[model samples]
Target: MKLSIVDLSTVIPGETRHDALMKSIDVAQHIEKLGFHRIWVAEHHGAASIAGRAPEVLIPAIAANTSSIRVGSGSVLLNHYSVFKVAEVFCTLNELYPGRIDLGAGRATTGPITDFALQQDRSKQFRSDSDQQITELVAWLDHSFPDDHPFAKAPIHTIDSHPELYLLGSSAWSASAASQLGLPYVFAGFINQKGTRQIIDSYRSGFKPSAGRTGVKSPEVILSVHVVCADTEEEARRQIAPVHVMYDNLARGIIDAQMPAPDDAVKKLGGLPSLETYMKGSGKPPRFVAGTPDQVHEQLTQLSNDLSVDEIIIQDMMTNHDARLHSYDLLAGVFDFI
Candidate 1:
């Protein structure tokens, strides 16, 4: 199976945003050298723990720093912006990076408070905007808008270079949309870890072809999940401790996105009355996999086989930056991704 990475550029305690960004570049270069397939930077506005608020700005830096390995926004939340502008920005990125740019689109909303902060007001039409945006964005890329379409008349900075488009979704709604649009789809398994078998099957069954689109004719799917691989099972579990803390905090309405230090997580968990109950996984989904190289490989292979996906993108979330890089390095060696 093909392997890729989705770096949120998680900001650990005591690390500034600058540090997180620099580390993103460094990790990009490291992964390129290690023979990984791609590295996608995430977009999370108004979140303290995630430093990558603007993946478009980071794409050029990452592409320039590495000779290969595709770079992209794991997703640009399309609901908040103009589809025309999104098309222009990624067209420009494609011109700069040529064959290495990917335009992955999603519908995640920055909380209503942040939406007001950014002056991104939403009318009732906002719910349906994502489908329209994706359709228009693809037309803009191919310069294929209907002749009578306003955009066809005005044009949006015509360009020959175009980025490959992928729809990012956690459920069947997005999956069906991608299939119908003839675009590649990425399932956010880490977010919607349950009932995935039906989701993927539904996507394939709903697929419709758009003439001359190879991805549409023979759909491609990628699965993104939280993973941590270490030298041993015990060590890997220790590495993911902080990740659990971060998730627990978020579920409890804590806004801090900061990754706590491992020791800090241990101490903090002692007082969190919900920690024990949460770990017991009563109704929790299987959202993550943490273990030694062999163990992780087995689980990942099983997941890929069961879902029949073409690739897997690891969402790197380790508390320590070095450990994060090490995990990818180990996965590369195990899978011979190079």
Candidate 2:
């Protein structure tokens, strides 16, 4: 099974955002050591949830600490930034890491508004405008048209090179675009996973190879699932409290989107319909690969078999940095691919 690691440890509510930043490099290096195929960092903005919206800045530092594991963006909200800048950043990373960088581009408002945030105001731009712009934006980077060629007036142009790019989404809109563009697809569940089967089916079925494209043929699909691993089933259930609390916060209007909770508090996050389903499972969450090594392996194999996924991107947002690092290690032991 092809398994990868993705960090979405949103700064738990009330915790200092710097806390997550400080541990990111270490967590990345440690996960790499544990034999993960690729380490992807997420992008979210506005609130204090995740400090990863500035992935161009974080990916390089993570790369500097790792020797071989591929480093990529869970997604860079393409609408809010310039393709030239994105291309330049990834190209630089590729030059340093040499074919070990991936640019997973996304369409949503990666939340937080930055001084120079990747996601701009949603109210101002037309919905899907960014996605469409990204379509054109990507072309500019892949190959610069002749000086007089069409689309020369494009808003975001780049000297395309290095850093293989992938289109990411959990919906059919992204599927259709990625298929038509012939770029690899990363379907992220961290932000949204509903309609995934339809999305992937549409992606694969609608996929028509494009020779004129600059990237690989017949887009590859990566299903990024939320997961946490531990030694025992009981322990796995106990540890996922923070994650449950985080999701619970998402369910309720608390909207703090920060600070995961302890096990005691996870019980308070009880409004979710899926929570009961998850609680009833033998130490696992819906669409989440969480449990003991054996259980996790079974879950992963099930996921792979069902989706025919080319890769599985994991998010194990344990309570602390050390816990996260440990989860990474244990996950490696669980997956044979590691």
Candidate 3:
């Protein structure tokens, strides 16, 4: 299976945004040497724990530092930007890095206030026309706007190639939109884990290639999940403790300034067993897959086979930077990426 990564540029306790970002670049270089396929940074606005607020800015920084690994937005949150401008930014990156940029688009809101903050025109009522946005974005990237359309004359300023596009979604609605647009679909299993099989199958069955589109002639799917791998299963559980606390706090309307260290997180949650029980009773599939290298490999392989996908993109929320790096290294080794 092809292994990829989705980094949140997480800010652990006692770390600044700059520190988190530098660590992200370090991770990109490390994974590149380990033969990982791609590393897409996530965009989360006004979140103290996540430093990757602008993927367009981060993409170039990562690309400049890494020689081979693909670098792009995990999802640019298309709701906040113009289709033409988004196209220009990513296409320019593609020109700069060629064959190593991906434009993963999504329609998630940063938050109501942040959404309003991101809007260019606050006088207008907020509305999301993600379907139309995706369609227009694809047209702009492909330069396939109709002759009579106003944007037909607008230039994207890139010649020869455009960044690869992937529609990021966690629901059947997203699956349908991606299918209609003939773009690759990245299922956000870490965000929403329900009905995985049905959503992907629907995407494939309904897929219709857009005429003259530059990439993805057929249905393509990549499953993105949260994982924390360690040399032992117990250690993996310990590493993932911070993520559990973070989720618990979010559920209670608490926004942490930074992800807590593992010991502090475990203390906050009472214990790992309590966290596991709470997660199981939350009426969702376990959001994280934390285990030994062999265990993680087995679970991921089964998940891939069950979903009928060849690629899996992992997202980890560990507080220890060294342990986080080691987790990825172990994962790569298990997948024979090293």
Model-by-model lDDT, in order? 0.79, 0.68, 0.84
Per-residue alpha-carbon lDDT of candidate 1 for residues 35-68, written as tens digits (9 for 90 to 100): 8889998988888788998989988989999988
lDDT by residue (1-338, candidate 3, tens digit) is 99989999999799888999999999999999999899999999888789988899999999999899988899899988887788878888998998999999998877789989999999998876588888888777677879999878865365346888899989888999989888899998878877676788899999998675555778999989888889987788789999887887889888745688988887887876321211322223358877888878877887777677899898987889999999989999999987
Worst 10 residues of 1 by lDDT: 272-281
TM-score sort, best first: 3, 1, 2
Clashing pairs in 1: none
- TM-score of candidate 2 versus the correct structure, residues matched by position: 0.84
Q: Which candidate's lDDT is highest?
A: 3
Q: Would you list the rank order by lDDT, best first? A: 3, 1, 2
Judge candidate 1 at residue 164 and give its lDDT. 80
| True-vs-predicted CA distance for residue 29, candidate 2, Å | 1.1
Q: Whole-model lDDT for model 3 versus the true structure?
A: 0.84
Residue pairs clashing, model 2: 12-258, 12-259, 13-258, 13-259, 45-111, 45-112, 46-112, 46-113
Q: Kindly report which residue stretches of model 1 are placed more than 4 angstroms away from their true locations once superposed.
A: 119-129, 155-157, 212-215, 271-285
